[model samples]
Target: MQTMLTTLILGATIAAAAPLTARSLVSDAAGQTYDYIVVGCGVSGLVVSSRLSENEDVTVLCLEAGALDHYEDDILVPYYIGLQPDGFYEWGIYTVPQTQLDGESRHIPMGKGVGGGSLINGMVWNRGNQESFNAWNDVGNSGWGWNALLPYFEKSETYTPKNYSGAEVQPELQNPSVHGTSGPVQVSYPNYYWPQTNNWFEALHELGIPTSAEPNEGLSAGGYFLPLDIDPINQTRSDARRSYYDPIIARTNFNVQDNSQVTRVLFDTSDNLTATGVEFATGASAPRQTVYARREVILAAGAIHSPQLLELSGIGQSSILEPLGITVLQNLPGVGNNLQDHGMIHLNYNYTSPVLADVNDFAINATFNDESAAEYYGSKTGPWTAKPSCAVAFPSLEQVTESASSMLAAASSAAYNLPSTYDDEPTLQAGYERQMASVLSELANENIPAFENLNNNAGGLDLALMRPLSRGTTHITSTDPFTTPSVDPRWLVHSFDYDVMILAMQVNQRILNTDAIKYLGPSYEYIPQDATAEELGQILLSGIGTEYHYSCTTAMLPLDLGGVVNEVLMVYGTNNLRVVDTGIFPMVPGSHLQAVAYGVAEKAADIIKAAQ
Candidate 1:
């Protein structure tokens, strides 16, 4: 960790940024007014703020509760993946006990520092699916369709084609014409890919899944190779800080303060609710400081904390706020009502025969790690550079489930429209009515996917439910800003969600029977042979996990439909304030969200600039 930090520090020293001491930070934070004050210096925060600062006349200030990550090995190295240590870099919080999973609570590790989730995520660069963004337009967000959002997606990434030119295997990838040549985030394929990927792709084909679709065009309902957010030149993680913030840190108009947690969004309550600035503090006991925003105050604190900030400032449900002795400035119940997450379950398989150059070799044999490290340092080629699973297939419901007609019939039925376990609030129910219709349309369409089957290649397959019907809530538990909010994803609460999980396991069994997969001699480690649907449902609910892609906490829809913000991303009933994060995403777009985050921030930057 120390060695990696030293190298990053040296790189920063060599960059064009002015001396760190010369930059305006907490010392210069108090009593200042900027055109834009962005809360949370995460992926979207840094992106939109930096882009706004491009005009020399505009001033942008970014505040982050956590300090900058020193670029430790666990963060920079792809081998470390999701195993970054707890505390400093992650907001490692646990959700409230899920009622359907026998009251079992789950852990959610969200990025906490300057670069945000882009700093700590698995770096899988996926552009979601075409229907996912088009659904946004259906939910009253005009001009948010695929054709409209595609340019921003391209504008956020600089793609390096993986169509190789050597004796090595060349994996099919996104077309160069569909991507940006000069974007802030660098995305490219790793030097090493699992040799068994082609075999797995063949197995998926044998199961009637196609592998020819280009994923980055928002049309990834089939198998395709995914790129990582790594610099093609250096082989290190390319996050928002490095890509968007570092290069523009020297801009005199832009300044970011670390360790400054905004406690509340300050507003003038005389006749009309209007954002003035925010009240923040360096620590819970530290003296509070107030900074004003001349133009607008934007929330980019992600799905978990963004709504918490809104409620802390009195913008959430009055029933929730009034009980906690907090005055309600706006009774917007939708501030934290539409919380959603991509639910996932993993099935581990054991290889009867050894798979050479496997990702698990490092753990199975100590000497193998040394050799991998040597290879990585020598030529930037090794298993250490590969993600746990880069080859994934998104199969539609008809392709994975046997009783597709009955399931679709049930989905279209009134019984599945408003399940008892889902929210009982009329507005939330109405909002779900719109969202459920969109999901059902996608499930019925053979071109859209119901789940993502990601072969870890070593021994596991991650089955992630792409569009879950279950909607939950994330609300402030107390008036205090330091208190952790209540996050309840309500996994498997809906009948459709349960059916998808159970059916996906059966699809796993079918995958093992394929000729290409049978060649690997794989055997399930967790699943019992010939288990009943009820028993299998129990196992799935017991071990269900979440993709780090938590979103839709504060949705963007019509105000009558319990949406927190408007089509323009501005919070309803408030002036000169907006939300620009995953919370504003009407639904979890496809499964992966990092690439979509880049696009959302890029588009939001333009929206905010145009309003200016």
Candidate 2:
């Protein structure tokens, strides 16, 4: 008995003497062992780590390049969304001069701090449309339909309704069962607004649009309401760190290292890709060191960096990596393909009344009266809890194009006094087709100028294509993990993408014309009232801005189609390496991306656990 006891004690002492690198708040490879190593402390990483560490034996290490964040004054204030850019927390990635947009580069604000983009974003919380998820299932991403992901959405959320008063003023949250009763994230709606924002909703209804109680309920058709992405108790932005990380910091098995940037994924020589460990830098003054992952390595570096990391680790396009001296492990051509983002545009309105002036103040909030919207939110009411977009309108491009073509044919028949058999007459039909194309293009362009002419203070509707068919590629310029790879999203690369944006702009124009919103948008300002459709098209092409919702860098398609991961989110060639970030999104959702990102991560955690 004495011998056995001594042996056990000696073994523990040796383990104790071993490096505590995993637990080391500041690791210099002192010692540590973990069942799973998750890279990036962003929303996905935080959720994955928290869920993976639930098992007592499965020790999880979460490595973050940034540190803990405080909801600072400017960040907490609703109107201060723009303050984060050029600030410390944003990575501030800019586009490589867009050819279509006068060779001008645009700023793409990416969150570099602890909570990831959630810390710096506009705090809009709309779960993309159900059709989007259904399409995913249809596209071979089985089990990703709206029905399958509903539970996960609830599991990660704590619904906070808007704080509006009066019976007609508030929105109703229809189904309580759809919302998770207990979740880490505190979702709330603010209690205040500029007072006149509801007029915008009224305008939508007058225009024949319906008011949606919960936009997150899988339908994002059209409505006016504040979005929910805040903590009602404190009136602060509800970031992922606050939701998932802060609550689990006390767990002994879960370790987190901030300010540690992972540079590479270490692998053995067998050519068998098992993520052995990671090399990271502590700080400017600290030396880079390696930290081992005993079981598996998960990359949650987001869309931009996930593919970059895969390429750095020899799991991406060989032609690009090999030229730069990167040893290719898996030549996945789809490392960065099918990139998509929302296209944004502003139509400012110079209010005739003093209505909007009150909103300029940070303390001022939007109000919502519906019991459900307010109740689900922490009593903060009004439009203040809503996302910047009070309404989302989904229009089908396929339908619009067909209708436009038919209209052009009809118009030609009437103008030329042609016979009804125009469809049978090839020459006449061809002429009608050409005229129709020209006229549609002109009409599409004409919508932009109408928006510019309305309201002054820059109140233009942002037109984000629910889904863009244009696909671009993401490739690494080098094998170096620390360096950012050459990313060519090829925005507006295809004509269909151009048409999608044009259609979205036209849709917004129609919304403005609707009696429900006419007062909110008064008059178009920027474009000339007499501007032709061709002229409007030029303006849209030149003036449009990005919505900052980038995805599809490391797409999830079948292995044969150059997908980086299989259906289970595993890299095609590796057994233990997985990716759970925005990089895995097969396509961009039709609404705000934050909630959907959380939902995806929630499901990913379960998959990871089951595999273990």
- Which predicted model would earn the best lDDT? 1
Model 2 TM-score, 2 decimals:
0.80
Candidate 2: list runs displaced more than 4 Å: 1-25, 28-31, 166-169, 224-226, 269-271, 283-286, 355-460, 514-523, 529-531
Each candidate: RMSD: 3.3, 13.0
Candidate 2 per-residue lDDT over residues 1-612, each given as its tens digit? 123332233222211112222233545342565788899988899988999999988888888887656445344545346644465577656666667656776776678777788877777776766766665665557888899989999998888565456423354454566777588877766655444555555655565545556656765355535356776655556678767876676788888888888877878747767788887786645676778888889999888877777777777765567788887787776676555666665544333443454333322222312222233233434443432433334433332344545443443444332223232434333433333343333333211111111111224455554544444555666555555555555566545555556655555565566664555444556654445567657876776666667786777766554466777888887878889988887767767688888988999999999988
Query: Which parts of model 1 have CA positions greater than 4 angstroms off?
Result: 1-26, 164-173, 414-425
lDDT of 1 by residue, 381-414 (tens): 7777885567887888877667877887776664
Q: What lDDT does each candidate get?
A: 0.80, 0.62
Candidate 1 lDDT at 24 equals 41
In candidate 1, position 158 carries an lDDT of: 87
Indicate the TM-score of model 1.
0.94
Top TM-score hit: 1
